[model samples]
Target: MRTNSFTLLRQMVESGMGIGIVFGRFLQVRRESIAFVELRDLPFASPPVACCRMAGRTPTVSSEAFAAAIKTIFHNYGG
Candidate 1:
């Protein structure tokens, strides 16, 4: 059934068999795939990135240091 398929897919994502297909802006990179296409175009679906929230208080750090750290990590990964 369709519900069963959805449950299995959710499990796959949670178990790291694959990454969840997300849309809007949360994903670091978005791939063009069937799941992406379907989810993005679904009339009943909410904006994927909008579902998340700030988990805790913001870190106390200068913006420049945060930017530098992000840049370093991305550069190291060749991303």
Candidate 2:
């Protein structure tokens, strides 16, 4: 089964629907029903992320600031 909702995916995993492969960030805490495994041997790649706004729409001050902040973070991290 495929789902777009993270909450639903987590619920299914916890309920023994099947094993779920997810990012380590999602498994922040230990759960009794779920065993966590880290596949360190696998190659790690960061997914491309975008900070986008609607085309032809005027940007708000807050939106510009947010984009600047995102740019600053990536620059600082050498992304």
Q: Give the best candidate by TM-score.
A: 2
* Least accurate 10 contiguous residues by lDDT in model 2: 47-56
Q: Write the per-residue lDDT of candidate 1 for residues 1-39, one digit (tens) a residue.
A: 133354464456445343343335434253322132222
Error of model 2, residue 11, in angstroms = 0.8
Count of residue pairs whose backbone atoms collide, per candidate: 0, 0
Whole-model lDDT, model 2: 0.51
Return the clash pairs for model 1, or none. Answer: none
- TM-score of each candidate? 0.24, 0.41
Question: Cα deviation of 52 in candidate 2 (Å)?
Answer: 31
Error of 1 at 53 (Å): 14
